[model samples]
Target chain A: MRDKTDKLRRIAIEPVTRVEGHGKVTLLLDEEGRVVQARLHIVEFRGFEKFIQGHPYWELPLLVQRLCGICPVSHHLAAAKAIDQIVGVETLSPAALKLRRLLHFGQVLQSHALHFFHLASPDLLFGYDSEISKRNILGVLHKHPQLALQGVKIRKFGQQIIEAISGKRIHGIAAIPGGMNKALAPSVVSTLQTSIREILPWATQALELAKQLCLADRVHFDGFASLPSRYLSLVAPNGALELYDGKLRIRNSDGSSYIDQFDPCAYDQLINEEARDWSYMKFPFLIAEGPEQGWYRVGPLARVNNCDFIPTPKAEQARQEFLALSGDPLVHGTLAYHWARMIEALHCAEAIDLLLQDSELCSDDLQRQGQKSNEGIGVIEAPRGTLFHHYRIDDQDCVETANLIVSTTSNNHAMNESVRLVADAKLSGREITPELLNLVEVAIRAYDPCLSCATHAVGQMPLKIELHDVRQGLLHWLHKDQRGDFVAA
Target chain B: MSGMKSAFSFDGIQIAFTSGQSIMQAVLDGGGYIPHLCYHPQLSVHGSCRLCMVKVGDRYLSACTTEAQNGMQVENQISELRELRLKLLEMLFAEGNHFCPSCELSGNCQLQALAYELGMTHSRFPLQYPTRKRDGSHATVFLDRDRCINCEICVRASRELDGKNVFSLSGRGSDTALQINSEDGRLGSTDLIATDSSARLCPVGALVFKQGNYAERPNERLYDTHIISETGNRRPAVVSGGYPELGE
Candidate 1:
């Protein structure tokens, strides 16, 4: 690969599209036609931490939800849980806990559905190298209309459940510090029960489609960004899959339990964030292993890999099938993220069904009154991964300090590593085609990283890729326009 | 006192009000609409929000402070006044740390409701991100100055209705803020009670009742089901009784 006379160059992919917020991928190359370094940079910053300082602690639940519209419920609940600490409540009321769980289930289901059907399905159903304009949700609509409709219905059902419980679907102000403010009315409970049953079939079909895709494209699924990394997620006391309330669990890359039953409030002791000058997002790693060696994966792939078993029957069956693909506890295939996401969606639907049937869901015991504490930490498994919201309040009950570890920020290292691996393997001294650049995006998308939430910005991203010669500069540039076409810029 | 009532046209609709009533009061009484942050039905009109600006005979004036007069044609819904109000809303958003997602008064906040009414998607101006302080010093009343739009509703209510003068506006222009009326400038040192009219008069999340935070779920808040334009001064009956009990 050596061409000593050739000059080194840099390739840049700016504003990575269809993955929530503004981000770019840069590839550094050596004179010998070898990839030197790959970096994922987050461009936008909303200064949520600096601005949220003076707000009251009780206002956090609703305030943090503004982090991402895609997974507002996660931030909403996570912040609420943190404020619950400030409120000095050890646990929420039974009814409040159940209601919050229902809300979370809806969030997970909708968010996963959105990722698979709206963002990823176009790539999965159509080939990865399909036409740029055709590789989108609208293309899926034109080709597989029924599947598209099912996707819409499933997402709608989840959003409706959220709206039914809270007041509105997005940024619903239901959860508060101690507990939630309102209970699910019996009428809404009945409506959810009826709708969830209908949605279950679509969720099941989604899981089936994901499984089929994984089996059919074994080479792509197995080799594409298949980095063996440690997995971390929240789990129930019994080591079952748990999203809403649980202790932190970590599984080694070789399919062995590393840490179990650690309290999330002490997350600072277990997890540490590494700041890099290249990106605004911080890379979070397990503290014991150090930053370089401790980078771990989160979200669906990690959740499925870390959990001992999924409680619901259908999801459990799907999980078993998914595990059979690797025969290892930790599945390394990045594409398997889609499979795990679908299975979780199935589980979310099943959980919603069960929760809706619980009569206590309609109970009016939504909140508990309590005195405020000066400090508190709240943690939950967001749709993207583990989220931590820590706050220090003054005697006046105002938030004096706030530290938020969002899901995307936690997966920062893994995403960058995947992007590097894909770029090194595919784009070494070659013309950067739209398909090659999209492969890098595919690696990032596998994590379902929400850059907007990571940077706390409020705009959608449009990806642009550029190649530059070391001496001459300005080789070529490709940008995805508003119409989803990769136009040569 | 004159026995006859004074009627005026607002947005092409005729509205009648008692003599000396402001245009905002007349609109509210007649079930008409005008976006306002400082004006309250039972409190003195403090047209500080400037959100209630309306065109009267080609000249723009605040509806909250301007009295309704016979044959006065008010252009509350005109495109120019609407655009001006939207701009004012944007300025209010930029001048303060109004994070709606985290605000307790989000769904019920007059500022938020008015923004939604006017379809304000995002603020055009750069955020000032002023470093405001919170006064959790009160026992039952918490004050988050960050969310305060400087509408002066709490200040007016404290001075006009409560008579305790627990709250007052201090500073100038962008630096203006609601100040607690006590030697130490803390709510805890003041005589303001949880049930004081001033405590409940805040249009934003600035003056929130302690222990009652998140008492109303997001969906059932004041403006969730009905827009402020439609609801006007008639608060939702569900929230009219104050915070709901955990078992209610």
Candidate 2:
């Protein structure tokens, strides 16, 4: 086959299935042995922030939870907290605050577990080509039924706790602006305590399996390559780690400079987003510079980096292991996503256990019964990362503008960079193998980008590297023998 | 949100009821099942379901139409209303869809249930199906067109309750078909999303479920009315959660 050097070839991933959000990737490469361009695109944009304007403050929890089906509880509480802040409404009681924290932890635990085992584990575990449809948790079920059941049980436990406390599993109404709608009943508390204790062992086993899997697939850990980027999160005034609600802080990968103590209300001033035409997800960066200059990462990596201390002992242990891997204070290694998730899960269980055990949690008085309506802001660490829901309201307490920045958007720059690096390493290599492509795809999945929450942008394909003269691309070539009519790539 | 605050004062207890439910429905829900002759718990709440009427301020209105206020003084079981309700029941039994013996819903009919409560021996009004057909084209449920009372229970249930808009009235006086609008004509044509209100709206044997026929006779089963009315009252605004708020 001729080198077909002059013309350009385009590879467009339309309606990227298996991923949570609407996203596309364009890989463009020239014939020579050099990289060209890599663009990640998010295609759909339903202006939810604009839509949420003029809603009643009481309805913020319900309204914001609509942001994503995958993580409604996070948005619900984030919006609730925001409303609370805007009105200067502290939680009605400690019990309500405790319950809110417990559920938020559950969100983190379950979401992380789902992302790792179900969505992003295929390529690392079964080598990606093990059948696309069967490459789900069901595939794990066929092989390791007990493990799959354990995963399901763990996720269900998280959901059950939320349902038991919040009134519903998905869009829970318990967490209001001032406080929770209802306090945890004695029977429900007892059930949760027992259930959490029971699930801990299963969670431990799953974590062990995850660790083994990570070690087994070291070569595929090219996605774990360290990148120098800033980490952002919310921390308490005393510099203690706070996930529920706190001041924003951004720290560079090196322990050099931490953007000390900024209010979340000033987020619009700090970070600006540039939307591309191709993808639904928008590219967000520090307002100082555009993508080329203002690339930063958030979520697991950022949270751990920004926080000065881990409150829970188990989480601290995992954090130590995380730091040891890279010998760097900030673990830029994406492969550590598994470790970060497990640590967060353990932290969640521990936090919930502590919260449930609180004497205040059993109080009969839950809501701020006699309190007046007020505007507020709720900032929390969603399972993926930092989440902020800001709401402005009128005198009648109707919400004006509701601006939300999900954790996925925080990691947009890092995700693009990670994909670009992996694409360069794998596709630019001497062989354009299926394993390489799978590895590259898996690398992107490691970030667990919720493109639905993020803005969409165009996918610019990197120039192709023709290692060997080929008749067609791998997908086209593989299907040629099976079907009567096969489209050439 | 302020209309008649002190005008409808009880104690100082505020409650949140589901949207679109009537005050009588709300009171009956909170374990105070009000009794009256015109209130046939099921039949499209005739405000005529007036058997459940209570005092709303100085003006006496049907509780089925008047929404519950936070502190409304409600008079469910008053001494003076018993004779009036008995008289209303006597008038209702005189109307159509009251074939006690041959009726499929005989043991469990709302009219029968109310008739037994009001101690009515016989109807005063004439027996009038008025040449109504047994339009039973629905494969699953049979509709005794003659059994329908034209109370618009099925129509309201189909449109408001189920959000399917499958049932509609065809004629004015006595010629209405419980038309399962097929081909946009009857309900069978449109997709009927089964909801509790839709299932509960059948006052007579006008609409019967395909399955569970004669499964549990009314006498044997507990219609204990209080629990039944609780769920009937709290028809959730966003019942299934995921469906957007009604207007949204």
Candidate 3:
């Protein structure tokens, strides 16, 4: 058999930087200088499911949060919802439900705001092709100090909401099996009430800035790494945008509906996950579509496109303008994710403002009683997309089996496809350019793919772009680390 | 000591106790600290965990089992004894499936609190991930043998305090097991009520009220604010269902 690597020159971008955790993108080009294959590889294989088998069922919400640093709250809520079923509580108390919803809004708001303003802005404000040193959060602070300050305070406000209710900013113990652990203190509600007044307007400004940036470069923005594929998210019973709890909505590339109200409990029957050799992340597809044609997208762009309308007034107005950007039923541009994310941030801020006013939040009637269930499935729209946590417990209340399809896992196929399309369209020869890296990286970055996304600064990874001939190996390499300057390693 | 005198100096302080009193009881009465688990004052002494090993003269012995004597010169915090106590704590940690972060007994656990007070960072030995079974069939109580230190406090409590004889040890040495003396070998089938001393006497998170986690929040849990050595292993005011039980 002939070795396939004999003819292909590999342009390997090891560890795409600035997103939580990291991934590698490899563009394989044949001797004719044509891009042959593009693959995004996630090497991490966290055995949380297998290892968590024997833990008490209630510890799941706390345990699964370790899966994602950026969106632990999403995992926590998702697992808690599943446990609610296990413990047999059909409906949480009004007070319990409101506190959970408030926590979810805070999570979505902080995550979306941080993603748009802190991580994705530098790529937009300073053009992608700009030098790496000036294309970062620091650079945004250097030129647009006021905008940077708004991003910081808005994110802080969102986190403050989380801290107020959950006790701490992350990995907090807010939701118990049947209900929340504590009532939201009136003082905390008052403090958050004061903070949201400033955040709502700032969220509006961020949304406008995102919309403006995309408008400035319509041609590039509309087409960069864009792909037409299916979209999936959670929507309210009335077909409105819902992030915390709702039925599943799957839409076609043309904005036509596939299934609008699939039961979350039957997610395993609706979605089929296929494992591939190249990546630890599984490729999930609709049961009807099969693996080849069933690949779909889930995240900000998908959520925005799949829903009828966002519930909050300001965000609903923003969504209408977003939909107006295209004559087609849905917007497929990957860059539009930032614009949609900011819209959700505004909605979260509004939701928090609305939730804080509910007097039930201060009620002592927190817990609900229920019958015991053996299995449960929970689904929620994390800032990234739909997160599913399904668990089955033994009679002893130990987690007998667990199956999780985090938002990033659900988008694995789409992220790979987006980057592949970009590499195929942009790659001409063996040469690797900053513009090419920008487009390929931005494709996945738009997903804000939570690859071990840690906010820790102590161990920021070095990015390596390698040119390799499979036969000779390691032809040339360029490196970028915490110093933010590219070096020929 | 209770005024019965056969005086012994502990850490350069005179601690007087009756001839038949164990060193642990004397230490307690003398207002001195010696970290211990499986040595509750309310339960019969088991001396299973060697955590309270102290050097008397040239040999170390379990303080709860060793009787107080005149001119004993027992040392609880000597270099040899401190290292040995830490080794014992580390062994218990390694032998069990004790992921304290996930364990409901976390801050309230005497084993955990004692480890914290001793300044233990990590276990030197690799964890033995035993195939332990957790029993949650009981309506209100849970039994997770993963965190069980084989102390037999539950066994003693059930027989001596609750008068149920619902628990007993079934194996020997490292393989020792807590057998629920029920027709189906389950706690739910046994006469072990949630309020039974057996259900609450485990020093670790081996047994606990099923819905008791995060009841007082982390900051208010038993050992959260008070060091186990200083607080003498007493629990914080009990909070059930997010409300502190009245009449404390």
Candidate 4:
């Protein structure tokens, strides 16, 4: 018989699935069943930083793209821009600049569509507590075949554009140091223009679905991992929404005025990274606020919250409606990340349409050559958030040092905070069910953290959850089995 | 050299070559496929990769070094040879850090193309994850030893073609590595230049031109659309001697 005095217990989840990389969650409980600590643990280590040291600076655009298959263009362009700085090119040629922008729009569109349709819609369309097998993209296809087809088409269209411009969809080779290595052929441009026009309505439907989900579960949306934190994003020179390149902007948690604005090259002066023992990912915070008080958020929700205006008309309409949810400039609900992602997808489609119409996109003058310098920093807005690539070169132009602050890494602290919040609110002394444990993951998924990019782990994301007590041993261990069903181990 | 040329059957196709030419050379000269890594026409055959193993009678021999005799029947594309080559390619992939996506020579990389040609989806062997050095000490050349298949093309090119012994193989077995000729083992201290034959001799991303990296868009590279076997038409012209014509 079990002792009545054995009050302490523990819970653990391992090998989390349906995400981009390997991660786990651990929960510690006190004698009274109150949660003491909850943490997200990134288990894998990819030595991209260590391996890139001896390579040449010019190889970084290609080297860093290997960091994540889903968003290689973000890293490619970021490394290129940094190299551009090292080459001492103040600005890219007009034609090269437009082509790079077009590539970025394609990247964001594809990634957002993947996250929304493949990962998030499963939980939204089916109830969070529904049968695990039915809560996936396949299930979405089984019930809503047309919607599933649209999702696949949307993602394919974005991938096609990437392939047409660069070469291949996964690790394309187009952007170079000073500019792009190639220009869009007239034939490829015409094909992309037609595809974008056909896909805009589907993007709008995705936005509508997100809005419906948000309205249907207002209470859950309002409280699910909804914590007050500062928002960070990139803004154009005119204070408009910018994804590919822009000035860094910060806004306080209460929908107040701007905290700071600075050039992306000067990121080190404004933002600082704090390394934690549990995870390979580093926590980035505002330099002035310090680590304890400086925890901020980036990504879709943060981008929508911080931007003054989105330039595209349809996206702007979605943004205005999203802002009306709270009647304030900032929306703290973590679930709203799904809504923000859909809105960004719409914006990307509209931006692609506008760029395709530009005659300069078809120009043959692609890249420029320049003198090399000693140091460079490139920053761009990845689908997840702001990505920074910093490099220092030797006299021979070989990379002496490389530092990358990916978008998911920037949101590390806030993600941990959200996990703690969800676990604290949901798991009190009751028996932990798969449904209860999934709520905790919903909080982490809301950030749409790309552990592959954040931890630099190769391949698919595997997640696990653990619950523990102070005196007792591990109470429960839950994780996705080989068939992707959440099973107790 | 003999005045009479030898004719051989390679994978059911008749190939004619000089008496002194090896089976691999005959196959390449005839534009037939037999995967090879170290056997450059301009360099001496190393036969280390063993990817060009072919069935002759009941036994197998390295095609790159085995001479093509008159009426020699070489089973180049048989299932046995194909399986052996696939195993060799898989071993090479597991033995090195061949992260294709991040590699600068992804589409143009000969090793990658050969893998695709052989229908190699993934490596079956356990990855060694060896810690290899990347030497960017050269002013115009970048040497990532991690991707080296030890084809010895650079070694032979430096010694035989460029007349500058800039590279050599060191150690043995798993610990074996490509070493530079400089006292400090740095390319910057060597006489090798960007235009040197040794610099362009690498069949992989191991030795690459620093400035020209990714200059040709990936889609337009040598092996993007077509496999290495189909690149016979695009192969650079071999001059009067054995060496390929320079600056083609």
What DockQ does every candidate get? 0.62, 0.02, 0.44, 0.49
What is the TM-score of each candidate's chain B when compared with the real chain B?
A: 0.90, 0.65, 0.92, 0.91
Tell me the tens digit of each residue's lDDT in model 1 across A1-489. Answer: 123212221133233333454566656566655555677777566578887776667677777787788899998888888878788788789999998999999999998998888878877888778776677778888999999989988999989988987778898778876887788789888888888878999999999998888778778788888889888899999999999889999988999888999999899999998988766788898889999899898899999989989999999998898898764656998888899999999999999999888998878887776766788888898998988888998887777888899888878888888887887788745467877777877788778646632221111235555554454344555665444556674
Off by over 4 Å in 2: A1-21, A30-33, A128-134, A217-225, A238-240, A289-291, A369-375, A428-437, A452-488, B1-248
Poorest lDDT segment (10 consecutive residues) of candidate 4 chain A: A452-461
Supply candidate 3's per-residue lDDT for B60: 83
Candidate 1: C-alpha lDDT: 0.78
The number of the candidate with the highest DockQ is 1
Candidate 2 per-residue lDDT over residues A311-386, each given as its tens digit:
8776776666666664366776676666667666767777777776877767856555433444455678887788
Q: Which segments of model 3 are wrong by more than 4 Å? A: A1-20, A30-32, A453-489, B1-8, B12-19, B55-61, B69-80, B236-248
What lDDT score belongs to each candidate, Candidate 1 first? 0.78, 0.59, 0.79, 0.80
Spell out the clash pairs found in candidate 3: A20-A453, A21-A451, A21-A452, A21-A453
Q: Candidate 4: DockQ?
A: 0.49
Q: Record all residue pairs in model 1 with backbone atoms less than 3 Å apart, i.e. clashing.
A: A62-B101, A62-B102, A63-B101, A63-B102, A167-B219, A396-B136
How do all the candidates rank in terms of DockQ, highest first?
1, 4, 3, 2
Give interface RMSD, every candidate, in order. 1.9, 20.6, 1.9, 2.3
Residue-wise C-alpha lDDT for candidate 4, range A1-489, written one tens digit per residue: 124222221222222333355567778788888777877876556668887876678778888888887899999999999999998887889999999999999989998998888777877888778877677778899999999899889999889888877888988788877888777878888888888878999999989998898779788888888888898989988888898888998888987855546888898988899888767778898888999898789999988998888999999988998898663558998888999999999999999999999988889777677776889998899999999999998875678888899998888888888888888888856467777666766777778646531221111224567677777657776765444556675
Runs of candidate 1 exceeding 4 Å displacement? A1-21, A30-32, A452-461, A464-489, B1-98, B111-132, B146-156, B171-176, B217-219, B224-248
